[model samples]
Target: MTLPDPGKSYAQKRDALEHYFDRTAADAWRALTSDEKVSKIRATVRAGRDDMRAAILATLGDDLSGAQLLDAGCGTGALAVAAAERGAAVTAIDVSPTMIEIARERTAMAVPAGATAGPGEIAFSAGDMSAAPDGPFTHVVAMDSLIHYELPDIIEALSAWAPRVTGSIVFTIAPGTPMLMAMHAVGGLFPRGDRAPAIAPVPPARLLKAIAATPALKDFTPGRTLRVSRGFYKSQLMELVKR
Candidate 1:
């Protein structure tokens, strides 16, 4: 079995994720995000994700009129659809072409009857989080997408994106607990086929310290936080806002 490669760069991890989600686990992911029945473990995961989504959206409050938002790493576009319903123009993107197509279909079915469609519309595409349109973006929401990268890489990404965002950037991370570290180790022993990319569990203090030291994020500050821990589903939801 291949051991954990600490030297794996961000691009390599991203390519792995693109392959896993777009090809290997595409069907499993689609099922998990749907209302259809799932296993007990995936059910907990779905619930935890739902809680995180609500927490992130709540931080922005309701009535997002005139907001230019980027739903970076949008999966099936659930949050994107919700934001659009609240009158925000959302640029929703993800690395998986299959997920993008699913998001587009979901959005098409989500149109409310006789509603004004121009201002709050959603543009869905297949690309990385960095593919976000030229901004002054009022808001950027990156849900569970960043959980696969190391703290340093995460810091670099936040630094690059912070200057362009006028309002806030919200995202999630897997906490670096001993149990998760064990899980990471055990994941390495699995056969190469049909295995998900390793999850990078990060400690909060370490992450926060790095964020504080990043030059580009100097103009921003950490905001409200929510931690959701359910069976087989653990995540830390965090917000970063302009100071």
Candidate 2:
């Protein structure tokens, strides 16, 4: 029998990862306790996924109470759960059904029984982030997922989604830093299994330009460049008001 093509099937990636999480969430949680290793991971391009979410939240500032949040490309519902924990009503969406399933399961596991109040409610679904349904969210977050699309595509996607946000849109992109370039070059030479889609790093300036060009968005601003390990993975935080 022919094996499945992993590259085209997001479901395959989701299934494999869900199984990994089911078998190892406890071990993964334990492994996260090593502060030295966590620090190293935070410094490199391959930063731990949760670290990216924390950084994004830090950038978002306080005053998130009762705000509507969207966790775009929410894998396993980490940021969604975090936002909900912060008392923001959250809707988490991913392209893979299996991923959404795992996210729901994880969210349920995190909530304590008989607790009257904790985090806000989290609704998980499978959908394309680039063309998500209309919801006037106070904040929209996309992390690590933009690397899969080219810069123009990323800009187009962001432009389409920007108007839906009433407050801010925060996202991280793999910067074209020297260390990251070198890593890319080495990876290109070795050719890993079936390469995942990753476009050239979208500079903060280019992202700004795209935001400016979009008709529905205003008040475009660039935020800090976050150093994720050896590579400088820049995250441009854009605040847009509907026009």
Candidate 3:
């Protein structure tokens, strides 16, 4: 993994990802077939998303009666849609236009009638996670999006945005582990089998140290960590709390 170009605007980097997914593979889950091997892989990926979504929701708890939520890097809008259903006014952002389109459709279908009259409205936009609409959000979530860059950039982005959130910032990463590293490498060898981008995991120790050193998180504390496995690999969900 490499740092984003220092001269490229955040939006520019985001656009590159958008174009990548759009031109490469837009719906990875749809590529799975009914073959026994494919079926298992599909199930695992689906379960992983479900598990991660649950973790994010659990971190937010049931206190979102009228909370403001930001779903940064909100691919497919699964979590954003769920949050809106649970009474959070959500602003979901993603780099891909294809993803934003699907997210808009999904959110429109999931949002309950009259829900928009309250604080649980849902909105979708195309932009970098770093460009998430300004908010003193009750909660912020970025799932499976940090693997695109190296550790330093991830930490800097997290630190810059931490102060804007009032509640916890929950994110998930493909942590660097021998098993997962191998999985990522092998997956790239079979791009047809994996529709998403092939991103390497970050070294967990280095990531943890950087998080600890972030100025914005100085007063905050790391929260729960969950191990979730799926599709021949495992991922870690970590939460950082300001209070």
Candidate that scores best on lDDT: 1
Q: On TM-score, who's better, 1 or 2?
A: 1
| Root-mean-square deviation per candidate | 4.0, 6.6, 4.5
lDDT of 1 by residue, 1-243 (tens): 132354588888777788877877788778888898877667877898888888888998899999988888999889999888888877777999898877777766333422323457877777778656667788989888988888887887787678779999998888857576555444332223545567788988889998988888898888988899876678898899898
For model 1 the local lDDT of residue 227 reads: 90
Order of all candidates by lDDT, from best down to worst? 1, 3, 2
For residue 108, give model 2's deviation from the true position in Å: 1.7
Worst 10 residues of 3 by lDDT: 29-38
Query: Residue-wise lDDT of candidate 2 within 1-243, one digit each (tens)?
Result: 122232434344444433433343324322432233533333343344546667787777555677888788776677777777677877777776656666666656333322222238777766677666677788788876665455666676677777788777777776564445445444331123322233346666776777777665555455445644433333333334343
- Candidate 1 wrong stretches, greater than 4 Å: 1-4, 109-118, 181-193
User: TM-scores for all candidates?
Assistant: 0.89, 0.67, 0.82
**Total backbone clashes of candidate 1, pairs 3 or more residues apart or in separate chains:** 0
In angstroms, the error of model 1 at 29 is 0.8
TM-score, structure 1 vs. true: 0.89
Better of 2 and 3 by TM-score: 3
Query: By summed lDDT, which 10 consecutive residues of candidate 1 come out lowest?
Result: 109-118
